[model samples]
Target: MSLADSVSVTVKHKSHAADVKPPTKTTARPALTRLERAERFWGWIMVLPLLIGLAVFYFIPFVQNIFYSFTDLDQFMNWSTFDINNYLDLFSDDDFYSAVFNTLFYVVVCVPIGLAISLLLAIGLNQNIRGKALFRTLLFLPAVTMPAAVAMVWQWLFNKDFGLINYLLHFFGVSAVGWLSDPDIVRISVSIIIIWSSLALKIIILLAGLQSIPRSIYEAADIDGISTLRRFFCLTLPMMVPTLFFVSVMSFIEVLQIFDVVFLTFDRSMVESDTMTVTYLFYKNAFYLQQKGYASAITVVLFIFTMLITLVQMAIGKRLKVA
Candidate 1:
């Protein structure tokens, strides 16, 4: 009786557990929090429009431009040839070499001058000076002024007949010098314009960099009896290497791509044929001569040069900092 009763109770207990059912063997997944899910959704939503616009406007055109460079793309659309002939022609073109030289010269001249002027201004303004704001405003005016207007004013000022500069030269009993006509002087004149236009932004950036430097460094240098020039070289400049590098690269890049001011200054002048830049050549070939493929090739070359220049500048910056 005891064995049968025990067995029956054990079977009843097992039957009850089976009927109650064990949990299913489903894998557990980590569910994102409500805030996380919302953030992910909004992040995509925010970036989607920009990505789309970039693909449509920039990426697509860039690819097309490169493709066109390999082909004989003309206004008539008659030539279907695709080869490296355009690049070969570019290498052989005398005008291309001239443009390259002019462009490099512009970069070499304007970048250092612009940086020096901006650095000087920024350093002067960083000190306590009366009417500092006024000086900044005056210096920055050229940057805000329309390039066309600046060219007009400068042309008149440099006019050999009655321009202000010539008038001043006359006051000194010197004959009026041709400012815009001479091929030799044209690049110098253009460089001046480029420096004037780019000076203000550089000053502002360098000034910010100066301000970001800790006052403790200067105080420590003063206690060490470092002279003004020594402190500037040892303390200020080393700290500003990053900013200087940034400004130098940007300035050279802008000078290399110069077109607006050149067009304004010389496009209508008799010496228009003298001051040619690579960008100007690009415009001329693509729009005027309708040599689209050659123009595209020039643009590709320019892009590569820009990248190489940026890398070289970065390397030089690191080396300078180490030294």
Candidate 2:
């Protein structure tokens, strides 16, 4: 071959060799170490008990409740054939409607008022005021108190003839009010008790939220000569949205299921129709009236209502940019 031909042939061979690349090797994930494997196994072991308990206690019973709602139960608690009559009867019952109305009234009256008062109390306690720790303890005491005891205390305070509340009213020339008896005023009376008892936990929550806010923000606002009132409206409120949202949601759920106050404060003979909450009504049906299937249906309705309300609150919170 000529020298140029030999050089050209060598270049062609080099180019062809470059084009034919070597096969790539597949990479496998590294095997976990024995320690890591043991850690994972222990983690699962720790969580398994909780999962089992939840399934056994909560999930299974919840499913059974739903099933029972669709089936009639005889006096002996034996399940009968499936039926939708319970729901039909529930819709037509005036007592059911009254209970629903009363429950909604509690929600509407208690939650907002409680939230406002709680926020104000939290702000006051968060200040550099003396005895704040004592105040906090006193405010939070109600949250830890038994619901039945609290109801009993308020029942005495609401006595028409000789209660402290009526005594004070008489001093101001107002007539003695029937706090637990009259249909027109008993709802408000119960609402007052609910709001009072709920304030403690809400105040604690708001106080924590307040403490989480950086002091530097307030210092900057002070440097700008911002008034405390202005700062609260412009700065504090915007920052407290998440905490407020949480408190409102919890309050709504709690108030919707109010039973203790009504059950403890009033009897079947004393304006039961006016004071009956959905939960109270459920208790009456399940235990007192032997209407287990009907009570189950009430619970299902309550569950649906709670879920819908929670969804609406979450949507509103997202719209407001709550964290």
Predictions in order: lDDT: 0.88, 0.91
Across 1-323, the per-residue lDDT of candidate 1 in tens digits comes to: 69999999999999999899778889878899999999999999999999999999999989988888899889875568989999999999988888888889889899998899899999999999999999989988988898889989888877778888878878789987777887777888888888888998999999999999999999999899999999999899989999999999899888888998778887544423678888988988989899888899999999889989989988998898788
The best candidate in terms of lDDT? 2
lDDT of 2 by residue, 61-116 (tens): 89989988887874577896798988998899898899999999999999999999
Ten-residue region with minimum lDDT total, candidate 1: 266-275
TM-score of each: 0.86, 0.90
Clashing pairs in 2: none
- The TM-score between candidate 1 and the true structure equals 0.86
Q: Give the clashing residue pairs of candidate 1, or none.
A: none
RMSD, one per candidate, in order: 8.0, 3.7
